[model samples]
Target: MGLFNRIKEPIFLKESSNAEIQIEKLKALKPLLNPEGQNIIEQDIKHLEYGIVGEKNIAFELKNSHMTMYILHDVYLEDGDISAQIDYLVFTKKICFVIECKNLYGDIEINSAGDFIRTTDFRGRKKKEGIYSPLTQNQRHLELMKKLKVDNKNNILTKFVVGKYFEDNYKSVVVLANPKTILNAKFAKKEVKEKVIRADQLVKYIKNMYEQSKEIGVSDERLLEWAQSFLELQKEMLKDYTDKYEQYKIYKDKAVKSIQKIIPTVEDKKATTIIVKLPVEETEIFKELKAYRLNKSREENIKPYFIYNDKQLKDLISKMPRNNDELQAVAGFGELKINKYGNDILKIMSKY
Candidate 1:
């Protein structure tokens, strides 16, 4: 949901008024309250208090003082559908910024390709697993904002991963359990500047956006439609996995793995696509991937066909071979592997 949706609506708007009554009814009902979700909401509420420190009027006047932020939670912009109900939509006179919040835990790394990987310490044994990258979703949100033709001045739309337990390995605009540690690290590394917004500032910015969106007569019709469509798509996507814990876990992990995994620009320019089958013993797939490339000449297709282990399948999707010549250049490409995995390799290409 966008940031502005969280605030109480203008008591006058007919739709908003009815929505408010429904929300109140839900609150009054006993079975509907989600205990765990409520706890997180409480924490977020507390953090928000600290995030917005300055007065509304003064914040607007100061340059770099108040960044109008619209708070959106669990928003999904899928197939042109907007995901969450907007928390609020903030429109500063100049630019509109959207803040999408995901309440999560652990340390995360978002690669240049926009893949999200989270690191966890389970019983002190560290492990890493891929998850949905917020960067990809944020970009989709930006596209929605553009479709909405929100004031063009809002050039920067950023995503935040908030939780009490994220490791501060890298400096970012992350809200963690230790605000002082984050600040100190920023200053000590001389990397501490304006990139990070304090919690109070975050709240103030969101509030500012909410008020401004109201003044600008922002409409949520399109956004709501987008939200409903996104929800449906999510259900469809999740249907492939079985409900069994072990069975579904693999799908869950892979579904997250696909997030931000494919970059269309890189795939578009490929002149060749090669499909290869790797030897079973080798450890590093990319090394073998590179070796396959070294032996091939430039005249061939830019795409590579790989019939390697199941582990290497996802990587190949992003590196799809452009043509038959490139497909033949892969590590274990032969008449046998080609005939056996040919259709499978073509299937991967079709996805992009």
Candidate 2:
């Protein structure tokens, strides 16, 4: 039944993304902020634009694949406090692919240990840094999907059967959406190399996997039903991407108002000088935190951003977390990270 009743082309159940909405929101809020705040917003807009272009590239490939498939873009799922913002979910008759898209501006290398390293050239110098593995990230999404499916079963036997089926059927893929990116994965493990591929190779990769699978293909109707089951599990994400910018705008406005009231009239002989402190980026604590990150990166032979990015650093400064428990409140600081660098970070924050 599956051989004769296959889908002719890709059918997109949910095609839109929230990234476009975020870009519009940031642009509207940019004019209201000060110079520093405006600069931050500009950087965010550029990042979002790059991501949008990458997703579109993937969409174009799937649209022109001429294969039987169901595609969902920008799916958000939550299991209790944990959440995943998946880039693409491609469903076939025999397998479902959970894809993570990276539109990076540099070359990528995968070592034998499965470590992801990115190298970029500035002027005549080459800078190399380790990046968080997209494969690992996509694997987490797959695990969440498996748990959700297994938990839905009422009996223990049914749960066990469902878990094993999900493990065999679901696949995780990391797609580099940047066409110009140079990938060097020769020394990587066989499994790691197969899971990572360029955007242009996505169609061929899926077809190859489909052909190798021994599982029987379902009809087009069954395929749609399988895809729709996941679509029904999608939840509305409550995260506000523009929240920090809004807070910065409020802080800038208050500073301006305070300066206005303190200014003296022309009749006054001595002019009052009210000095407003610069933004957090220019403070001594910020510099020290950056220095610590660089030193720690060197010590661990990893990228500085892997420990914490610039935005996360600023969050630490603003929140001034004094212990491991408080540090957990910051984004990206999981149990492993807190246990690894939590004490040192707390010590640094104690100085100021």
Candidate with the greatest lDDT versus the true structure: 2
- The residue-level lDDT of candidate 2 at 146 comes to 89
Question: What are the root-mean-square deviations of the candidates from the true structure over C-alphas?
Answer: 19.3, 12.5
Over 106-214, each residue of candidate 2 has an lDDT whose tens digit, in order, gives 9999999999999999998999999999999999999899888888789999999998788668889999999999999999999999999999999999999999998
lDDT, residue 292, candidate 2: 95
Strongest candidate by TM-score: 2
Model 1, which residues run further than 4 Å from truth?
1-84, 150-352
Candidate 1 overall Cα lDDT vs. reference? 0.36
Q: Write the per-residue lDDT of candidate 1 for residues 43-111, one digit (tens) a residue.
A: 543444332322222223222333322222222222222332222233333233444333334565544
For all predicted structures, in order, the TM-scores are 0.29, 0.70
C-alpha lDDT of all candidate models, in order? 0.36, 0.83
TM-score of model 1 vs. true structure: 0.29
